[model samples]
Target chain A: MKSLDIWNRTYSRAFLDDLPHRWQRRAFLRATVKTATVIALAPLVSSLPGCSDQRSTSPPLSQAPWPTLAAVQEILLPHDAFGPGAADIRATPYLHALLQTSDFDPEERQFILDGAHRLDDICQEQHQRAFLMLDPALRDPLLRDLAESRVGDRWLGALLTYILEAMLGDPVYGGNPNGIGWRWLEHTPGFPRPSKGLFHA
Target chain B: MTDHYDVCIIGSGAGGGPVALTLAQAGYRVLVLEKGPWLKTSDYFKDEIACCRRSTYTPNLRDERHVIEEREGKNWKAQSTYDSGWDFWNGNVVGGSTNFMSGFFFRLKPQDFQLRSEFGPIKNANVADWPISYSQLEPYYTQVETEVGISGRVVAHPFAEPRSTAEFPYPPTAEHLLSRVFDHACEQLKLHAIPTPRAVLSRPVDERRACEYAGYCGSYGCATGAKGSARVALLDRAIKTGQCEIRPHAQVQRLISDDSGRVTAAEYVDTVNNIQRVRAKIFVVACQAVETARLLLLSTGPKHPQGLGNRYQQVGKNLIFSAGGSGRGEFEYADFSTDQAQALKQIGPFVNRSLQEWYFINEKQLGGKRKGGTIDFLLRHPNPISRAVGLRRDDNDELIWGQALKQRLKNEFTRAQYLDYEVFCDWLPTDDCFVSLDSAVKDKWGKPVAKIRLNSHPQDVIIGTYLSNQAKTVLTAMGAKNISGSASTSPPQNLMAGGCRFGTDPKSSVLDSDCRMHNATNLFVTDGSFMPTGGSVPFTWTIYANAFRVAEIIKHQL
Candidate 1:
């Protein structure tokens, strides 16, 4: 199936299912999700080649963005000779948790999801595969090319911002587990850290 | 209707704390209406995410925002704080911005009270002598040292204001090893390195504990109630008397007044969005400078049509912020021995040193007899997230990811300690910089929000640059590498005052010397709003002292 068709069908069903019963009754909210999805994906859909007849094996809309984002984060702060990278610091999970928050800006959440889709499209255009299917060496060059564009640069910067948060933020926020990032950097955290109850309270 | 209060104070920061405490102690029922939540010391911690990244202690910009108008070339551009992400809201908790202050306290020198007399006026600056002299507020400053808990060892410097007390109520908080180096550098340069006084407690004072030296003083609420915020030092004590009621999340909409031009009641929106009214013999507005002026302008009464105390259009005419720049120098570990490097890396303790050598610039090179400023030296804050975020871009402003970024982070983390200097100077009051209500933009309550026009006086930069250059010399003397500093036109949002300035002439000023509204006799503005000319230092100490001074005046009136 085409990317837009898959996104429309998968996202609408998945998002509606996630909403509370009270929220489900709000027609404007459902309309907003559908409208947002179409607006966010229109450019990517137009850029992609015809692949509607291809077997649709993409993950559900909710889970589709994470693997690409995680791949991008690993390339951004790869686990090479350096001590701890994005994966080691649990950046992707932290980002996922942040996006799930009620207080998190919805526009920013959509931007992150849209940016992931855009990255996949670029990967397919440059090399005939999804971002997750790319060779490890090819990922960095693709991200560098993405960084050349204004939106891509901002998206990467946003991801880096979250990665830094994961690396340095309190472990209670789900990143820097066991203070591994802190220990590596020789940073001494102040006392009286927030309890789990006060995580963004 | 609620029980009648002798006084209704509409803020709980440094401005309102003393009035509430003093009135309640004198057997009067005082009600304090604070716009934000009442977060105790137990609710505070040193979480970087909460303190720096999120608007935990302040209002969300989307709900309550300001319209900041800045000059872009010859034209002015207005942008909402929500769009710019430039947070104008300081600490909105019960204690206000004082909760997050670094507690670097300084008293206004005697000359500051007579700025117009001492230093002749600059071209476009509205320099005016204070209506009240320093002598009138001296005793109160001394009182704040004991009651509000200032900690420092007094040393005679050329520019040290005459203190009523020989020494601070509490001895200075523990100092870092860098202080010694700073002192030595100052000695070599023939400069008087005064031990910077802090509002933080050095030892246990009643229920409050001493400083924990958490290296996260600025921008973070005090976890130990040692920073001497208004809530901990004053309001908490007032509650013990059973005469003071602190109603948090009670955002006052306006002061309701009678035709006789006396404030009869304060109308506020409660936490549940219910409109509540309470009668009081006297009403005090101490909501800092910008919001204080906004409150008065919003309160339109029959007797005072334009707004209470705004008959002459002087309610928000002279908004001032501290105009200065900050610089940092790195102390590399490789340059020092292991012991020295270890001492350099030591955290928590403060670099309690300041230089007021240029407080009065008599140099002929710049200009003869110009007012200068204060230079405070300290350690760079240890917020690792902020530090890491700053390093995301390379010298060319390109994203540096993967191995390059990781190595950069590692090097920055382990390499050297950074010492910083902050230059605080007068943001000269002018016709251009003032607070007014935005015509279109409304707050979450559907009331017009504060619109601030920021235009700094050119001479402020000249003085700030002079002071910053002097600071760089001391840093160079301390053997710091890559020393760079400059003066900026950007205003420090935290150190603000002088919207509703007090003066003798009713036509030119909002309040009289007693801080009571000139036309509306029963209404008083006890915050930094009463400052006609804010001195070249932090305003908290002055605000605390003046509030204590005003409280005594209110006591006699009652």
Candidate 2:
């Protein structure tokens, strides 16, 4: 999975257009398609990458290869004077967990995995190190190149979706701790906000 | 229990729900075959990923997809559903799309009933008059407003159609602070900024609770069962009567007809993949517009070759999808006075407002007299994940990431509040837009899926563009900064109607004035399929009203 070859063709722009335009299709998809996936993604941050206790019995992320994806997401949407960033909300691990779930399409999972590898390959060639090891100063060039390419746009769009989940999605799903994202933006969530629990998949 | 029923209805949304509730209450054994499972109140929650990002409530495009055909110059190129861009909207759950609808209810004016008579032939457009008048359906419309639980204050507006009832059953709830801003702006423009009528409930009725204002309206199902969805308002009541049985996960394959040309049975694949058959005295086909036509075309028997009621070749012709454009305007809270700023910060899920000033077509829009559309003013969806994803810019042509992209997103989220605008214009059916069985593509069930060919008439775009400009003007009057949005050529695939058009003539239409098939005496179509012309607004209310009207006729005949 070096490139987009493994990404499911069903999610392609051509396929999305087979219905209507992208933004509109996505608007309706909220109620029609993603309900179960929303509950499935919900869980406490699962004891970040390495620091875990004996009581922690969640899946291990030792070989998950999430750092490059994390670095890219952080570089793409870092926290500044504008509210919280990917680092504060744990966007990378939230996305990693989402990709591992049954709710995500198998092909979409392959696409994300392949995109991370390709991004790392480009980072290594430019900065003389793997993507995660690259200096914060040098990460922009790789993102610039990826953003400029057609293949990289899908990856960017998908990453942005998860980043949004981290910022605005229900906190039970391992992001937006303590309603910080909602308070930052002042978005009045509809009543009956969920408690911490996963809906049956 | 008898395997036979008094009525066998396929699909269970606005089209079938009302009729099922009415007939079952009237002591008729009604069997409703829904393609999806029966979701409970506990089943629905604020799960954005499951309800929006994945195919949990709709047909899995990977297994079943519609083939869309695009016409360029001289060729019609086909695109398979296998692609991600393929429009895969439309609910497969028991309540159908109504379970997730925004519930913006607007009645079709009297002029909409006679499009062909009002506006003479306009080149290639296939606009026509509805077989029934708005007056005929007005009483049923009132019934839905009360029984189905519509909540809004009816005001006297120039662009509004005539009302049969004196007032709505319930007063509007969830009126946001932004609605007053729109009222002020519209007062400046002298446009009728009517309180947009929503099908969602404002107060508790019987066992259901009032809207919780969860901000999760639209895409997610109502946990409180206050949205007036079929499952909440109609099916639940019908179940208590014990006469209505909803057979979930039963996909009706075809309508089995008798030698006399009337549909006698519904053949379907049950949940366990067994081919189950149900006999009925009367059959109603309300599987939505596209699937309704597809099912009829797929039922090729010895007596009906082209398909059921396709002998006149009018079964799948003249399909119309509503065309429209959308625009969003942003306003900063810092610019407003302290009182206004406080109100702006507290905006909630509801901001029901729309201008019907252009509901009737005028000459200024088309350079000549013609039919026009409506403009709906709304608040941006509360789903923050979609809002952030919406701000991401990586369409390949331009790329912004890292700090620059992050800053842009933050500004969009926190800087200023946004208002959404949508123009709903009529899609005049032409020879270009219709549904047929695809030869090459097949669904997971091994059946030929619908092959849709869509191309909107040029006037549809012109009227929608004029209405969109009017929407921008409202934003400008309301002191919105960077206000922009225009009409597009894209048709809203979900708001589909026509195909199995109803008319008095057997040669020109598929159904009679009562929505009964012209050829089959006992078969009826109660969905949007019988609509010859979908008016300037959404068709759900009209579909529900018409279904209620048809239910009366069915009862009379029985």
Candidate 3:
């Protein structure tokens, strides 16, 4: 239960500086995969460490570590004023687990994992560090290139698009942690709570 | 008497929630009795195993499943009755079914209100004209939409009933992952893929806000209160006013009768701790269709030995279950991707109704394997569960199954959208497909459970087949591959109708046009049980409308 603001300050661009372009993309994909995997495996790995009610557990990051993967997720769905980022809500591991389970099909698993591999290869050939380690300048360009590519295989752009969507999507699927998504949308989290003026204590 | 009120309403779901609020607002002392507990949105979770398998959010049905037997073939057939499909099917909470509904709202067509005259009398069907016309109920329908804060567009359809200009209180919710595909496919097919009208608020209305893109809106309860359940809309206001008193855990067993054959009060064993009686000058039975009919039958006295409203034996007669069907398709296009499609704002509602083309589909034949029926309303944006189970691919190249299936399903698992169009033909009431009391068995409270002996006639089968084929054709036009359809073996008794049907003829029907029970001078029935003929649309909106209408009638009387 780290303060969300503390987590945010820890994730500034300075932490991502000096890493090469290709490596940064690879790292991002890795984090996305890890997140899905953790979500899928949350039920089985309940006793890993932190268990805040079965349904409310953020993904287990320690026992099942996806270093490159976790960092990349931070970059994409960062915990900011925008909403709950995947990693901020600690959803990366849950997502990683989700990928392996029946929740997702084999093609989706392959797309996520294979797409990460392809991204990493490109980053390695160009810049030096994995995607998350790269400077924001280098990392941003790589993401743009992937998104704009219509070449031998359009894996980078497509995977980035999918991951970003999931990150910004619903809290019902491990994203938008807490009422964070609602706050970002300028709406209240739904249910049982009374309106701002009516019936609120 | 433990407590007394000017008007006492039973069951706090669709009918009771609205009526209680309206009457209380109008300054009448109203008391509402609810059998289920009141739950908030936070109580719900997003686990299919718990919600679907464990039956976490539905009525406990262990006894009824064993006791109620249909005379199947020669021997009595016992259907394994469980909760329909989590909270989405049947919720036993204080908000009633609204707590777990997709919120589709369609008005009963003009013809639906007068089926006996328009369609002529079909053999064996208890077809009759409604005491009131659709035009008479239009104002109340408008009031319901406004109060519930519906988000819809009044699309133009030739056969659609006319009404004053109205716009949905909020905009339609954004299509879900699967809905995007269905939208694109519908655009390609040139057929109307209307936004299913939902009771949910699209923008903040009153105290609630728009949808949060939570994929669990359909079956599982919405903790956000964005969906227009009674807890969110009516019950809260009614309770806050303090003019209405809600007595939870009061499961009414029988309607007490005076010496004059009028319902004097209701008897019940207090589900909480104490068994007590509460008398009211007026009584409204807002219990759902099955329970309403069963209560009427259980309270048999000398004046009405058959039941409360069974002078003509029509109390539990003409049971109409929703005639339901669906179609699924797989498409190849990146544009249909969930990410890109969210930008294309505005999904249309099945708001426009055409009697010529979009009329209820019927399967004329019965007693065997036949295609299902159709009502209008294409439901897009189904969450994961519906896509996994209901929208599976078939054995065709375009359909795409097996190993490639694994890849495609995986890729689109979160992105692929399943477009669904459900047709609900208002089942014409038949004397045979009705609810009765199981004399041999009882429930947890030792009251007779609702014994449903239902078998749809050949006409119902005709309606089913017609609707199912029409659904297939609509999907075919949309390039839907691996199209399939099947009718349920059980009769349309599932949709529910008539324990207290409304008509002018006291000898034939139970209640009057205002929903007042014929025999009981002060007792009124306001649920789906009072429906003369089931409308060819989802019944919730109409049910709310009728409740409002009756509330107005009660208001005038008060």
Candidate 4:
């Protein structure tokens, strides 16, 4: 059931966009399931943090196969007053390293790579500009559409997973720089911290 | 050590480790064939995703595949372990899955030993009495504790089986701040919350180090040799004796026996995929229940066509897995008026609290008191990355991306500390739940893979629901604001047992009381495979203890 829940919310959620009627049904179902589980708990998060607190910004990724992804990373988890977002943490490097070194599926890697290229085309056709050059209000809705559309769902879904890894994984990797992510979350990491001694070595 | 051994052990976890140690001490040369790699202590790390995601200590399923078929009606449908569901969690490394276990040890009560006699029979379930009693195994449990090392206080538990020893070898590790809250909650509810005895060393024992309270302890291997993993606790010591040889990467495919039906040699594909046969005077099959049964079902020969000990066709019958249901209760700092909320530090690893009062419940709603199970309350694993995945959905039920996703992550991580509770109930062995060789699927070696058929008995769902409800009550008492739990129809894959059951009746059971095959004389199965009915508890301690007892019996034969 954990697997089904994860599959539905994680993978299937990306494809629900094309069918707005079916999407509403799924969203209602998701809400009903969640409400049943958390009814006794505190109400859902009231409002998100303010979206503009950019203390540190990574240089635009030049070497990347899809350079506009640097901007997409910001769009996905942009700088908020609470703390650093994906770009500030340089999530792309960590995600790239993870995809390269870890036991990543080749198919997933290809999907993400293809998705990056496809997303640019989608944005250009829809908004008459590349994803990176689009305005923030215009930029956000297009990305949300990509998440819903089947064309970019799997790729965007996987991208979100890797981005989360960057934000919360050990700072030893390039992401979560200076323990910024941990500090933001106020998460006290478990002891006997993992070292490079056994990891990639 | 000679090329050939007095005994060849097929696994390296709780079952095979003790036998290797004891037989080596008795001056017999022993060979241990572990299919997985020898991940040395130097390989131990606290990287959760690397260890979990990389299949670091488990089977890389693309090559080592299993066609897990769930019951869909009259016919069975093979579920995708990759895209859809789970594969059977076989700890594929040298120490086996024991290295990754949470180490919650609870002795099986006497009633568990004689479940058929005690509780009678349930409809369609294969509950049976064990050939050996708890008294027969008590001395060895003490031996296992003293030798292997265990920590935690043993207060009077209403459901705790009688013990010969006064207390555990080591006192409980320093309590987490949540311990006090849990205890207080249980006190108000009038449920017994005793210390959860663990197979972890609280203090330094012999050559092994003590618990460093490494918060990354549960799923990850111990960087410090505090948790009593088979490698550090047994095989490491067995290697020192110079009589035991651990041959990693030797995948045993077939067990060859003579016309008289006694085992002769084991043919295995070595690291470079060479068919290497090693002869031993005796052989012990302890590669867990599923694989042990798989090995037996795979080794088909002229003498025993149904596979090694399947003359009675009971090689893989009455499979049991622990029925599991869990709930997480989130406690934000502001939820409590008491200073206990502020003091709830997230450092110490073990919640170390369990309520066994419901282990054998007699509620009238069930018509009578039925055999229930154990519940362990735990602090959620401290890793932040996996927790971040919890933010995928928003209250509106729409997928959260962009700024909304960012803020949801912030709210979850900074705002709350959670107590996770898991209830382990009896997975009543019904004929529907068993293992067979998958005709369609094959592994990397082109051998037919094990086909696991799982349709859990309705009783499991009933017992799981009851325990989960009880867990909610305890959480409610603890002042948790958001608490939600649901009973699971699925079984905990890791806690599998009873595929190769032991009994006097040749018609119904696979192995005999001593875990020896009824048809094959020289073969012995010392894993959880020998269990007729796994009690409502973690099977590791019992598997270890029973293996120790069986080792002594095998000792007399040698």
Top TM-score prediction, candidate number: 1
**TM-score computed on alpha carbons, candidate 2:** 0.91
* Total backbone clashes of candidate 1, pairs 3 or more residues apart or in separate chains: 0
Off by over 4 Å in 4: A1-64, A199-201, B336-342, B395-397
Which tens-of-lDDT digit does each residue in A1-201 have in candidate 1? 234334334434423322221110111110111224234333322322342212122333237888788888888888876689887887876676666554456756786788788778777777889999999888898888767655566678888988998999887666787788899898989878866434223
What pairs collide in candidate 1?
Answer: none
Arrange candidates by lDDT, descending. Answer: 1, 2, 4, 3
Output the TM-score of candidate 3.
0.67
lDDT of 1 at B385: 90
Assess chain B of each prediction and give its TM-score. 0.99, 0.97, 0.85, 0.97
Worst 10 residues of 3 chain B by lDDT: B345-354
- lDDT tens readout by residue for model 4, B428-524: 8888888889887788898887878887888888888899999999998888878988789787888889888889988888888898888888899
Off by over 4 Å in 1: A1-62, A199-201
TM-score of each model, in listed order: 0.92, 0.91, 0.67, 0.90
Q: Per-residue lDDT of B1-558 in model 2, one digit per residue for the tens? A: 249999999998989998899999999999999988788766677766556655667866766788888888899988865554565447887888888888889889898899889877778876678888989999999999987899998898887788977778888887777898889998988878788888888889998888877777887888888888888889889999999999888999998887778787889998678998999989998888999999999987666788999998998889987788999898797898888777676654478898888777556536767677888888877677666666665454355666666666667777787889989988888988899999989988899999988888888888888889889999999888888898887777778889999999888899999999888888899989998889989998999999999999998877
Evaluate all candidate structures by whole-model CA lDDT and list the values in order.
0.84, 0.77, 0.58, 0.75
- Expressed as tens digits, the lDDT of each residue in A1-201 for candidate 3 is 122223223333422221112111111111112234335444434433333434433434432234455555554444554345555554454455445554343433554555454555557666765555677667645654554333212333223333333333344344334534334433222233222111111
On DockQ, the leading prediction is 2
Rank candidates by TM-score, best first.
Answer: 1, 2, 4, 3
Which lDDT value does model 4 have at B21? 90
How much lDDT does candidate 2 score? 0.77
RMSD of each: 8.1, 3.9, 14.8, 8.6
